[model samples]
Target: MSFKKRGPFVSLQLMSRWKNLVGLNVSIGGFVGKYPHCFEIFTHPFRRNLCCKITQKLKEVIVEEENVIRECEIDAVKRVKKLLLMSKNRVLRVHALRLIRKELGLPEDFRDSVLAKYSLDFKLVDLETLELVDDDDDDDDESLGVAKVEEWREVEYREKWLSEFEMNYAFPINLPTGFKIEKGFREELKNWQRVAYVKPYERKDMSRGVERFEKRVVAIIHELLSLTVEKMVEVERLAHFRKDLGIEVNVREVLLKHPWIFYVSTKGSTQTVFLREAYSKGCLIDPNPVYNVRRKMLELVLLKNRHSKELSRTGDETHEEKSDVVISSHDDWEGERDGDWVLPILMKSD
Candidate 1:
């Protein structure tokens, strides 16, 4: 998409120069060939060199996603406000927010479009930090302290008729399929779930018990995932907000400890932590417009070969086929591994 803004197409040589920067191990032309549905490789009309441009379908999806994000500015503001409220200092680094902007459904120019437009609600402490502006008219400060998970706990307690002992201070845990439940695992999981800790939005004291501190970290990660559009986030991206959010422990270890509450997937280059309860059969239970559009793009990428074959059959090829470049099959791609993408759980026996 960035290449599209520069011109109709970018030379493969130019793209190859920065392939490592984009984390692509394969040559730029080879990478572009793998996803024919999203990109088209062609001979440059004047330069006579190999070049690539995003396909019309992908361009439309990008525009549609941008439109959807713009339409959801109000909700984005609420998400930002909630994030600010959940932080330990009631302030978040601009760089940290930028890392997870797409996950939070913020627009590309959110600094101007969302935060600056709603200046009364958000304040720029400096060029790099953002803080929420306090509303003096609102006397109910306690209401602001309630985290999103507390609402779920309330629902489990009242509507589902779950006892406080079972639901209170507990997160909704959905263990993955085929998870081996060893003889004392259930009892241990139950005890861990029942362990109380300070909520993500609440204040914390200086007490440093290991169990309490770990549980608090779990809650912080849980709330962070809940705020995302897909109920997942890159583990390294979460580390960017560690100082602002008070996540002092190793983020990946904390995620690995709570198997039921979080699932760490080593599918891509980065490790992503998925909130287990938010997904059913690998699909989000509650997907938003931005997620839907992004999913469409993913679907397009997944069906690249089929789309290319269809275009060939219908005589609808968009680019010339005279080039000597050999596009490899999807299986030849570097990261195309078979079987389940989820990493195996490494549980320690008590």
Candidate 2:
């Protein structure tokens, strides 16, 4: 029986190798399951085309959305013209165009958002560049037809998890003038505030997550301006520590987002120190831990704020490392306001 099975194994090996040569990309598990079936059909060459035919069918299924999106683009171009004319200023025009394209079921690529950020630069002014016109170009030239617009549309149209500001006349309230509330600005605000300030909550409702969500996301962002003062206090602590130990790390590339405090060493390496733990432990001290941590924390709290670029960006790897680190807020799940998602902006300088 063993000798008789040798011929079958050889034929199976040949068929498996042939499948690989044809670039079928099927898994070995499926190939093993189909081995017995392949032997009976070996004499028939046409049966081998099954794998190729299946691969083509899968590709067609994936590409079917492309045609639907092409039609969506044709409709969007007509709508954008009307939207552009109705907008008040360059900033409002960008927001209006984004809303209209979203409403018309057209895509807004990341590039479109970026262009919207600097809409003043790309306006169709009374100029001499006729070559800039391209009929093939859709209004969302930034998406480059990878169907990002379609994906965004799907997210926008979902019954649940609708953007709170969508179709609502409510602008970002409690904001000073010269600032516009753009989509996804909350993400940037949270990151900036996290870097800029650190404060303890006396009451649970006054906690970062609860109070922040109840107010406009921008209000939480403006609160970060206080963080500059926090940084000065942190630097003073670092100065005291270095003076005691007589060692100088200089603490360059410092990113002081409290509760998950981060900084870079003299070697340009990253170090994250939790302020709560560091203060409690001997790692962060001002001659005494129990008596001084509270008084020292409050004494410099009222100082004027100043901006420092030292903690802005470290490097690409440090940013990537941040992603792998889990960052769950102490109060992530409690109910509050809707538009309160925060994310970080990758500044150019490390």
Candidate 3:
């Protein structure tokens, strides 16, 4: 993914290292041959083998990618800022943030670019925590500030419905279709959903209704998942943050209780909990800016694939006119031979 890691070119002799991973099925020369417009093979700088270099067109594509990241930076900032504001003390541990910083679209030196740049909005205290500044007088940057308490409520026009205790965030549950539900389970969830408890942003009050405790558990998990790039995270990874997030021992049971908001996929060896709202038909529905940038990264193609498409569109004439390559026969290639002897760095004893 680093544009300059290979120094704008790679040796054909080393293509095998990347072929399978990059989905290539041709020899390095054939690969470069297929995309003569996008890639060229030249003698290696110091070695006898040849290397493939990206054409000017590919450089232009990389430039466009940089522009997209710049355009999406503001949206990404608000996303990460909202996550910090949602924490219990409006602060989260530095280590915890680092774990998901890539998923949060933070650059490696976020302390300077993101945290320092948003100094009025965020601060790294004691080099150990990221805390949100509590000033809320300005509406201009509210998106980067603690969201209004009322906004946490899942439903609007709450004054007309339910009591003061039920005035808490309405944790809506929309189960996947055809999911069987027993009457007792439905009844318990109905009470639990209506039960009011501490939101992820508020101070915890242990003294609460029986159902309120369960609601808080769900809220904690909800906020945690919301912080992810895909609004989903590995169940195993989530377990590590249990103590930090103030989760109880019955985390697994709590996750099962809300199949609507959270969907656990056993696709991998471990379970991954996905926020249903962020996905549709197994694909991310509204991908975050971080993920969008990754998607753009994926759009990049090896020179071979790009060249093949160009030839198909313009015919062999274009390639004949453009390429001056004279590929050598495989037998002439100086690869490892049966009689070749290995050299030892240390001298043999007499």
Candidate 4:
């Protein structure tokens, strides 16, 4: 779960590698039996413990969502557009983007989908950097397709206020119900709430400036949240890539520092931070195609649970512990017989 990037499934055997994994008390086979939809237990053919793989249905759902992401590349490019425009050089490092690309719901080949199609709006420089450029070459270029970002923001602007005072609307904050506050917390909250606000896409020169560091932090975090479908994430998950997001080591303090722009939910044991502007009445108002596909995947997982429950009544177990298997001295799943299949194929070809 810690090392693997976003994938179709996670291997439960990783607990063996870490050894100190807490809270997981069940055997691998029993765990798969519990969530038949999300996981499938497979014999490694050599390794003693069973290996967990994603079901075929999960793979199909993943592939379908990949197509959906491809169709929604324009939305992704707009996100990239806003992100690059937020940066000082109108460019961002590709490797850093790689870390959060899936979270942003960008196609694996976003360069081909966004930059290649609209050559003037975006440019890939020296293969490692993505830069935002003017599309002055073709004034009528619309091949990149229309994105929901523009229309959605326009609607928000109109609905929130009349033409004159539209900018003054307060972004709502939602804290978890059980959160506790210390003495004088209200006075501190008021002091932190007064930071100057900057629109994400607009450029500001904060260098050699006072009180600008927190404002820039807000802008970067706001834009990062905007890129996510949920407009929120596990506090620890976001903390893992603070440097990649260009925030300071202790920058998560900024969330506690500014209560107006962020909301911390302590519903779970750990905290979940949310962009207060992104939600209304505890529900997200954004229309994200990526988010829709994720919901579809959840629905399929639920359906798989139902199907598994019915099938299990036939006395066919989902996973069974193999008592006779030996724990090999090898570290990886494969042992001395790893390359044995290649030799037979080579001999047959001769």
Instruction: Give the candidate number with the greatest lDDT.
Output: 1
lDDT winner, 2 or 4: 4
Residue 226 miss distance in model 3 (angstroms): 3.2
Worst 10 residues of 1 by lDDT: 341-350
Candidate 3 overall lDDT versus native: 0.57
User: Model 2 residue 187 lDDT?
Assistant: 79
Ranking by lDDT: 1, 3, 4, 2
Rank by TM-score (best first): 1, 4, 3, 2
**Best of the two (3, 4) by TM-score:** 4
Candidate lDDT scores, in order, read 0.72, 0.27, 0.57, 0.54
lDDT tens readout by residue for model 2, 13-56: 23344455433456432433332211111111222211111112
lDDT, residue 66, candidate 4: 83
Provide the clash count, candidate 3. Answer: 1
Top-TM-score structure, candidate number: 1
Q: How well is each residue in 134-245 modelled by candidate 4, as lDDT tens digits?
A: 6546433332222223344456577865342332322334454576778997675444444444444445544343455655566567667767766776566666445534
List clashing residue pairs in candidate 4: none
Give the residue spans of candidate 3 off by over 4 A. 1-66, 136-169, 207-211, 227-229, 236-244, 248-253, 269-271, 283-293, 296-350
Q: Taking the tens digit of each residue's C-alpha lDDT, what string does model 1 give over 95-150?
A: 89998898898976888788888988899989889998888575544565677689
Instruction: lDDT winner between 1 and 3, please give it.
Output: 1
Which stretch of 10 consecutive residues in model 2 shows the poorest summed lDDT? Answer: 341-350
lDDT per residue (tens digit) for residues 1-350 in model 3? 33334344544555545556544555545655555545544554334455565545555554554565456666557766676665656776777666555555555566667777888877888787878777768675454433333454524455456554655556646778898887798787666666667766565565376576777777777776766666766676677556556675567777876788888776524567877766667557766555654444344432335435443322112332233344332222343332122110010010
